[model samples]
Target: MTEPDGFRRAAMQWLEKRPDSRVDYSWVSSFEYEGSRIPLMDRQRGIRKPAGFEAALAIRTTFTAAGKLPPYVDAIGDDGLQRYKYRGDDPQHPENIALRNAMKMGLPIIWFVGVAPGSYEPIFPVWVVGDDPEALQFALAVDEGQRFLRPDFGLDEDTRRWAEGRTKQRLHQRVFRSQVLLAYNGRCAICKIRHAELLDAAHIVADGRPNGHPVVPNGLSLCKIHHAAFDHQLLGIRPDLTIHIRQDVLEEVDGWMLKGGIQGVHDTRLAILPRNRLEHPDEHRLEERYVEFLAAPVA
Candidate 1:
């Protein structure tokens, strides 16, 4: 296999060990080769081309302002493909040339999107398919499946809408999950469960609802069981940060799972929360969700 293909395979192997699909800066910067560490990304630049590569191997968007969303839009263009800005003001910059070279060679690279200040969600095997020097950007597609879709034949209107919506939704959920997990120290807010594999970032207000942006304050880190319970209205969190199990669930005469796992936590405040108050769940969104939970009919 070619070097890019080999690198992608290695990245996939590394990602397999990280079920949460989130990586710290350390992981992004480390890929060993012949006992020497080969960083997947540039330590000081957004576009990374390593020592021997003619094409860029990875690109990243950064989240610099604390408690603020990343500035990179990642929005689909008129051609129905996402475009990443070239590094700096000059399109002829060496790093930007590296990205253009990748596009010309049809090489696949990694895209590390910042989910937190120093944390990222990696999208690999991303092909740089188009270089718009006038726009100072390069077109990107996530996988092999999308790499073939060209700007010459843009997506139909309906298809473009669907693609845009789906892409945004998936990216939003990923970033939200990473940020929420980081804020809560990888522990479930309700049960304090620290298993990253079992945790999810539950939304307070459903997506597409008013003020339901996929943001840290609009999310809660919960384990699988509690996430299901929260989604099904079996559990709720009041605006005051108090936990509440549905009356029926609290009264259910089920076995240990229900007794200790769900019921035992009724009326208790959340076991874990972000140290920064700004990262706390939005009280208003919690109130709206809590009201819905209270009105849900018991089975």
Candidate 2:
């Protein structure tokens, strides 16, 4: 699976130059190498499911690059069923010998997963681990959007059930964050922080609460610290869009993180709003959760 000399080297150079941010399919469209000859994109960018990925993958990855593997190609199987296995560089291409050497060294290879043309960076990943045949199966399990399923993971019944349950929960969290982040344009609603990976979709109503549903209106994009505070009842968002820190938490003589990051912002207006008012947090949902926040023992 060798091609032009610097193909992989140049492509990886592009990836490395990108901001140290989570790579998500929705965040970017496509990246080009050497202008346009080595382009990184799923075949088409509109398909929203795994079908889209498979379609785009035909052109997205290692085929013309070093390993000739698709963007999401499975790890080398122990069953000896691998096709397009990297067979080493063309003897005429001396530079490709280095690429071959690197492959022999077992570097961690990752592929971004999401709807493509891969114009945007990916938030989700498919990590390739040798001998872990379930890597792809488990990847699709958590990526409910991809709707990947594996009926033959070889796990016992009970273990499989537990794994499925955990995967479903992760899927919900991922979908919830994707929606809330897009709604707020990737900024925390309270702090206005814009790092996508650092933000989370904080549930307004607890997920298992009677009326709780995993809809965008029931979520808020909060930074890691704020999401933790909100979930622990140390902070709350009012129906009127004000911040509420637990009285004791506000009064406690705590460190700068507490004062500047949380308590200090109490009662201030929320910093950002979704472009569509209909996408705003549901007032009734917020009210229900706020009551519990008021009732919780002070942190």
Candidate 3:
């Protein structure tokens, strides 16, 4: 689906702050049941209550960063409820008071159950609802857009066509992670590190956005520190798949450690090379970025 321009911008900003390193999702289930001592009957019935306020806050924080809202919010009705009103000159106006209320409660902007006041038994025991300026801004934007396109929530044919094109262009970084995992056999390309916790898919080329494309040829599999170094141009990989050390950096103590620890040994060949040569870095792109690296003053 085509997201609004403001939403797209906000999404990009949130994504940019995300680290290039990998995160282990394998242990997520363990943490889900932590510190819970509900009765055996409740556990057997799978009737775990909703998370506490702190837990909900954490979930919201993650969802916002991921450029999405919680799925639970999608249950508000089209007619709206309570202080929220869905019917007006611009019923589908994104900025409707009801829309704001739904979003504020982490509900979906679309029609669903449980969003209307007094619709069902309270699933959430904790009342953690507080003012969030970001959510408020999103609500306002939706409201204005709805008002502008009143009566019909759908965009004009021309606008809809344009949105379709934009939707295809929005790259999900998760795809890159998958590509890296497949390329390196799920191991860190450098140091032959097999521990999943220490491995990451490093971008051989810079991130594709603001003119970068998230293509396989532009990525690599390195650990967290190596990924940061590659991004900062603190490290470079030669076309021959050898590691290239900045001359000045070669003399520093930390640099020496890197050289001996990882960079020094990995010369002449890649620890984990892509099976498809076409997916490897473009020689020209590497050369261009490498030249820029050489021009930087030593710190």
Candidate 4:
């Protein structure tokens, strides 16, 4: 009914029309508003408050190394809500003020999380729920389910832990996938398949295992079939980057799909690798996982 409400709804509708993969930096940067162009985020600052808006438009969290939290970590807090740190220690700072205004107005905003260098995953309609001047941060709710949570809300400790763990896992997986896929240029390392929908960011090391972190170095971009094979120990990649198929599976007489798609790639090194050496799969993890593959029981 209100002008600001209309603008916010329009923005959400516009974003909803696009797939998550298409919401890159360029897509986020441009928006047409009232015959004028509005850049949703600042080129330098983490928080964006357009000149004409009473509240902030979007916030960003920059990319950090795997297993490392960014300078401003957006983690689920003790109150069972997401907490976003302020731009700086100043509560009265313009950016902080704008965010506070959004909370007061019940306005929704975008939360751009950096998945790789200069690349981000945009989460929209995150609401600023509570502001803590002492902590110099704001509380956020990503969905309607979280909007009603209060500090005094009696959440069972176990339930809280489960909620937090599940939320963190989903966020971490998304970021990991984005980073891994981007590093490999959206192509499967084993077969060089470039269809993103058919590709998955497979981990060389399981997340809870020793030295397992969801970083790019522990990831490989694999198509659905190869990913399933890797998980089932039907295929493995050595630290030397050589591919191996389980002996039985390799020796089996099978159709073209199994022969060409799986067995045909045996003894070959990864067809694709991250351009940045730092993003390459960790040799130690590869060796560790390869051992598991070798020990896997024959079906």
TM-scores, all candidates, are 0.82, 0.53, 0.42, 0.84
Worst 10 contiguous positions by lDDT, candidate 4: 162-171
Candidate that beats the other on lDDT, 1 or 4, i.e. the better one: 4
Which prediction has the highest lDDT against the true structure? 4
lDDT of 1 by residue, 227-283 (tens): 999999999999999989998887789799999999999889999989889889888
In the range 39-83, model 2's lDDT, one tens digit per residue, is 444344221212212111111222111112344443212221111
Displacement of the residue 32 alpha carbon in candidate 1, Å: 3.9
lDDT at 103, model 2: 29
- How far is 50's C-alpha from truth in model 4 (Å)? 1.9
Q: How does residue 91 of candidate 1 score in lDDT? A: 88
Ten consecutive residues with minimal summed lDDT in candidate 2?
A: 50-59
As for TM-score, the candidate ahead, 1 or 4, is: 4
TM-score of 2: 0.53
**Using TM-score as the measure, what is the rank order of every candidate, best first?**
4, 1, 2, 3
Ranking by lDDT: 4, 1, 2, 3
Cα shift from native, residue 275, model 4 (Å): 0.9
By the TM-score metric, which is better: model 3 or model 4? 4
